[model samples]
Target: MRALRCPVVELRQYTLHPGQRDVLIDLFDQEFVETQEAVGMTVLGQFRDLDDPDRFVWLRGFDDMPRRADALESFYGGPVWHAHRDRANATMIDSDDVLLLRPASARGGFPAPPGARQAPGEPAASPPSLLLATIWYGHGPFDTPFVEFFERRVRPVLTEAGGEPLAYLRSEHAPNTFPALPVRMNEEVFVWFARFADEGRIDDHLNRLRHSAHWSEEVLPAVSQRWARTPQRLRLAPTERSVLR
Candidate 1:
């Protein structure tokens, strides 16, 4: 058979069951790392819900549609692939729950920008936790060098400062969009979400950029290169989330 030709890019979100998540998490880690090394594939990232272990999101970018189509059958339909798909397919394979998303840009990271973050002090409800998120759009094309600089310089600043990285997100354009998704979000976008304690911490988190001159020289430019070309960048906080528990 001739190879499939996908004109744009592809984004896929695979949701797993409670019992199946751990198994698939391990599989995806190995699988993603391997896939990132393949031709036309770049920027692989993953996200897991803070409140729920069963819910997770991952993003990967492909240069062409043909490789993307062949990849679907190639990855999931392969011999070892059943371990991840078989369990979920038994439940809600076609449900709106499991999906491939193409945001307006490529970075379908975070909660899609709730836009309204509650004030610092509000009436206390049970389990008071402020979900702090910062989503970045990758515009730079220098994948290998950027990842290295990140590992050596940027990532340390984050970890050293007590920031919890929820996920690193990357995506490809999807020709189709679901009713839940905005139609304009049909292009490549890259993003990642992280949570913080509260307002002061969130403020300080942004301030970290100023402290790291080394980080600035070595890292920021790398990410900026990837982000500049992307169409959109989402920066949002939820005043109230349904608490995807």
Candidate 2:
């Protein structure tokens, strides 16, 4: 697997006004992708949340925390954002549902896609691949033991069951250096991402895990005990410019 060059990542979920998702996505794909990268961050992926038509989810990464701050300062302060901010903001109901995260393991960050991302105005791939993002919220911080548990026990089961692990990330507890763009500060979460060629593969993978004795008897019990709430699973379809697909 290719190693992620950007250690600092953001999982951004925006709730937009009804019927405005495509509008914002068009604007974002056209204006945001390369411009943000030019300012020193990677636009990892952009997706349309399958469960919520009005919601848009995306990821971006930076070299580290300090660079994250610098990049955000530059991009948000730059002329492009200034010119487009109003139109972009008009499509949103809320943009603050953000999560700050870092790789849970040394090689857990998302790898580069096998193919190049599409240029502006390029059409989305026909029947884009499906991406699964599972978020596990915890009452308290995910301690070292939990991270180890996931890496050693849970991950193997996932891979063995047909899930292609894309990334494993835990809550980044750093103070929000760019306070203008807020993140979920009071919550603790562990999130993992996987990719599938199609919906059938996802179902097959889940069925395998559900039937596995180890997964059902051992993993489920431990996860339920540690979990603060039920996990959030997002089924996402990549936009044309997404690199994570």
Candidate 3:
């Protein structure tokens, strides 16, 4: 299947109860994937946070704001979620850390995976590539200048340093259509996703960026001045059925 184009996306991070991450992942992979897609949404990827065992991270996309509202209404009110909601809710301590975003530019969106996603009931295997999700919190929305700066300066540096840029996104100011599931409001963020071969590659990539004087002396200072706080970095391993890996 061709990858769906998701102009709007959600980066959802759930803090789960200890030892319950796997339980939720299994249920999500089996029950949530196809059902959501049936309702006009794309389950882009699901992952385990390598740094935090109790955290469950996932990405889902929508065609636009109106469609996002419609899809959530259908899936959340439908029979599947109703049947499994309790079990899923039981595993979560918190599920409200969500960021709504849009592609930074015309071409800044996820590409189709090289192969088909693993079928349901197939044994889970270790994914060879690691995904990195980096978020930069800013005082105000990242405007055209910052976006251009990233595309022209920061992105090339990352590519040269061996990270494969998957997507670059900034906050979507659309109102929260579905009130049942609250998203972080009044926040400004810039997020980028990348892939590396493994942990070793990630380390090497970081080392290369750090050693580059242009990055340290030029790009780093400009980025620091624009964002309010330290960026959040997530090291993610794709779940068995994830297409991104």
Instruction: Work out the TM-score per prediction.
Output: 0.40, 0.95, 0.95
- Provide the overall lDDT of each model, using Cα atoms, as 2-decimal numbers: 0.43, 0.90, 0.90
Residue 41 alpha-carbon offset, candidate 2, angstroms: 1.0
Tens-digit lDDT track for model 1 on 44-149?
A: 3344544445555444444455565555545555554565555445432222332232222222222322233222244323333444334444443324444456
Clashes of each: 22, 0, 0
How far is 13's C-alpha from truth in model 3 (Å)?
A: 0.2
lDDT of 3 by residue, 1-245 (tens): 33436899999999999999999999999999999999999999999999999999999999999999999999999999999999999999999999999988776888866676678988545457889999999998799988998989988888888885788898998898888888987899999999987889888988998998878988899898878888999999989898876
User: What is candidate 2's TM-score against the reference?
Assistant: 0.95
Off by over 4 Å in 2: 1-4, 123-127
RMSD per prediction, one decimal?
14.3, 1.6, 2.2
Q: How far in Å is the alpha carbon of 99 misplaced in model 2?
A: 0.6
